[model samples]
Target: MGDWLSYAPSDFLLFSARTYYRLFELYNRAIWPAQILALLLGLVILWRLHRGGARQGLVVAAILSGGWLWTAWCYLLGHYDTINWAARYFAIGFVIEALLLIWTGVVRNRLSFQPYRDWTSRTGMGLVLFALVVQPFTGPLVGRDWRQAEIFGVTPDPTVLATLGVHLTVDKRPPWGLMIIPLIWCVLSGATLWTMGSPDAWVMPVVALGALGLAVYRLSSARGQSGIRHSEDS
Candidate 1:
């Protein structure tokens, strides 16, 4: 019993590296031209952000919802659960995130995009570009085959990363609640990738923490400004 207690978390991984990469290849093949469409959606969102489009929030939310639902149904529940029992729980989290986006962005209209030329906005845009364009190539550049490449909207990690990027660009108060799942997923996926000894393992958690730190800074700055305005009025 004592010996069992000392086992590393990696010891419990349900799939081998070969099995994991094979799953990605199979999942990519199953999704086909949808990856192309996802790329197009990402481009459109990028353009909207650049122009400060009025309905940018709605569009971003709708696109993210689609990605999350597709990943939940097609990858997590449909394929991943065959090997890892925990995938079922991950699928549920993706579905919940999708629902939250729809409810807040579409129904309640609480989320909107108003871009500015601030460091945060530029950083967000840069992250979006990385997720949609650079990220897919990273796998191949690092020795993984094209078949094993993870595309935005088609896969979980890039989609989550890109979504976090969009949230960082919000001109007004950001939807912190909507960020919760992506933030958590980044940490979870980072740990999983670390266990697999993947080169990109550190990327997820680093981006997650960076975005979170920016959010905290922005919140503090806003509060300070608000307090000054109140004092002036008083």
Candidate 2:
């Protein structure tokens, strides 16, 4: 198996290719324990969330499954960028899972799980906010040093423009684009929990806690409006 810890942002293009090849090699040998583990973990979360009456679990399952499927397709098509983009999408599966767990188990008390939902939610939101507001300006901090000229190599006129727009919008560039990193982080953590043992599972629990905080804030706002409505009715 390839060393997941050795991956760097600059190697994303080659990494996607090599990772896909490795995954395919594993598939051919019928040694897909890791992939199966991830799939099963996703399914288990979906099942628990569904059983607990959390509607978000369905969306989470779709995102997780769809993202993985898309990544596989991108790999088959030799679209390295698409594969890299899908990696970010896959990362969000963790946050969605955390959200479902919190809604069903923590807030609703449907399961005998730890109470980390609020922290998890907050961490997810904070990371997302940081990615949106800070990551882009500090893109060089993460080592993605591709020059703008090199980025647009050999692409035609309109295609070049569209590609440039996507790059500027989604790449580790400034503005709201930086949020992709945090989004990716959430997914990565989720995948880690799914495939590897969850010794560091507290990281995701913290994220769930953060999300709970956001949910509380939303509920409080709703209650405030209800109070005003009651006042008017009186």
Candidate 3:
């Protein structure tokens, strides 16, 4: 027990910071044009949201599920596992998340996209923008190589971030089931970066919290609206 107490989070890291960042560089090189396609897909989603229709939901959901599957395969099982054995477990989680999205969003067709034009939508968009654009610069801002930048569609962190953003934008109550994997990943990723002594360690966790707050508020507002409808019917 004393030995456990003596160890720190940094001590638990098996890879050096250089190795970790270089993984992204190798990964980016391996999957070149896919990043551009992913970014374009992200833009298409935002455009769909801006158009505001129930039909758009299917496209967005399917795209999101595909993105998760891609990350789970190409990034997690294929690449990340070589560096970190735990990535296999992480891949499992991502696979589950992808299936959930497919089942709920594609099959059941429960999700619909139309911004409520409130705090949830605004915050959600902010997250999406950050994932698509701002996140890449974060590593570079810290003097890390641009080749190491994590992109939205391909990388785990930004993919999760963008998914959470899209979840928050759902016309229905935020899907807590769908959110579970992403929320867990956010915390885990943040802590992992923190262990690596990375400056942007707080980013994912903070965004996770913000997404959670917006979800709660959206849920409460939903409940309130339901109550109002019930009263009016009575």
Candidate 4:
């Protein structure tokens, strides 16, 4: 048991930091102007979040669905899986998440988008800004080349981050199921980046913890509200 425990996350890595970042460089070049569209999508999401209605909610869900699908195919399977064997499974997870979003927000029309005015909502908007405007430059600020930057629509990391932000920002009683995959991905991403010794390694895990706390608090409040209503009716 002790022998098995001795292995650190770095010991499991199959590629060098340079090789990993190079994949981003190549991916960025191949994708070209998609990054511009991705940023525009982020701007649109931010703008529409305030004027949220059912239609706007569906739009948000559809955009995220497309982003996940794009990352699943373009970055995960096409790029990262070649280096890491587990990335194919990650791609599967991304696809499932996309479909889930479609099922919940599009097909079922279950998501109710609202402009929540609270601390969670405020924090969520900050996350949205981080994912859209800040995340792309994070690698570059840490001394990596601009070519290696990850964009919201083009890569899994920022897409996942944006999803987290959206989940927190819109729903007064956020969907616990929808939050689950993003939280899991957060832990996985943080571990992978930490293993690679990236300076921004702390971001994902911290996001996960914050989201989880918010989820619990929101759910408890929801249940308490229901119980109060039930008592009053009785």
Candidate 5:
């Protein structure tokens, strides 16, 4: 049993790099124009955030909720699980995330966005842009076919990355519960990509960690401001 514990994560992988990329190719082809629509929806979310209204925020939440649900059903459960049984568990997590997004961002309507002004907000916007625009180039730039490209709103990695970015741009303290899955997923997906010998293996972990650091910074700043306000009141 101790010997089994020494096994690397790569040893447990059920699919090859070729299989993983091919899965994405097939998934993309099967989905067709949905990708384009998703991209448009992402742009709309960005516009809403820039405009800054509660109705706009609700729309963003609804769009994000739909994205999570779609990824859970179409990618994880419907496709990835066929090759990797573990993906079924991921599908569940995705679904839970979808529900939480709806509950917190839509039903309760707590989420709000602001124009990027601070270093963190600007950085967050950059991450969001990377996920939406630059991320798909990783495959082709690394010598893989464009067919294997993963886009934000389509694939899990970029989706989570973009979500983290959007969270960082929130006008108030970022949603911690909303971030938990994406943070875990970033590490897990980064490890998986690393084990697969992917050229873009570092992106996921770097984005995740960077977002987390910023989130912590924002949280501390909020707390400090609250303390100051309390002291003044007293």
Candidate 6:
């Protein structure tokens, strides 16, 4: 463990025969900073939403806070192994926050879908898919010399590929189940956009963007519908 800590970021970044070892070392350091920042940013976002009277923000805040707190606790205990394990779980916070923000902020607000959200979702999906599916097939694709790469910059190592493939394939069982929330959000967004003028205005950058846009439109329309209902009730 001490020896692993001695590796430099450059060692992980560069693609060499021993890159896998260096990558493992670098990932340990990298995740801490990223997790910390994500946690802080998520909190700030939640605070803003709460102040703005967004009830759903509470759920986002809770998830992010829990992940951040657990990560911090693991770090303080000097449980590097646990910290590493927690880091992966902490990533769920990132995904959840991103999804919520896209669904609530842009979609609900009827704002145009931006490239940032599309890219993030696509990249995340790709990584998840790679982790779950492509990774497991590595041993069959390559030889037994497969070792996983820990850092992002290096080429796919055998272990890394196998692990990712396996994780993606196993985790995404019943694809419809995994996709239900996003699908509903998309339907709502689309309905809202259709009610508004120009349903076909923007070209979707990706399928995800299209889904997100439709979801947002739906949310905005729901707000409108709710306001009308309140007026009639009053």
For model 1 the local lDDT of residue 166 reads: 87
lDDT of 5 at 93: 93
lDDT per residue as tens, model 1, 29-104: 9888889999998898788778765587778788889999998999999889998999999999999999999998
TM-score list, all predictions: 0.95, 0.26, 0.95, 0.93, 0.94, 0.21
RMSD of each: 1.4, 16.7, 1.4, 1.8, 1.7, 18.1
Candidate 6, residues 1-234, lDDT tens digits: the string is 999999864344323323323443454465545434443544443343224334333443343333334433333123323323443443343345335434543355321111123333334334433433453344334332223222111111211221121112221121222234334333432333233322231211233354344444444665787889999999
lDDT value, residue 140 of candidate 3: 96
lDDT of each: 0.87, 0.34, 0.89, 0.87, 0.87, 0.35
Global lDDT for candidate 2?
A: 0.34
Which 10-residue span in candidate 5 carries the lowest summed lDDT? 110-119
Better of 1 and 2 by TM-score: 1
Least well predicted 10-residue stretch by lDDT in candidate 4: 109-118
What tens-digit string does per-residue lDDT give for candidate 2 at 10-38? 44433432353344343324422333443
Q: What would the per-residue lDDT of candidate 5 be over residues 37-125, giving only the tens digit for each residue?
A: 98898898778877877597688888888888899899998899989999989989989998998998889888877748578887887
Residue 73 lDDT, candidate 3, scale 0-100? 95
Top-scoring candidate (lDDT): 3
Cα RMSD for predicted model 4:
1.8
- Over the stretch 1-234, how does candidate 4's per-residue lDDT look in tens digits? 999899987888999889999999999999999999988998888877877765887888888899999999999999999899999999999999999999998898777655467777777878888999999989989999998999997798899988988888766688778888889999998988999999999989998898889767767887998999999999
As for lDDT, the candidate ahead, 3 or 6, is 3
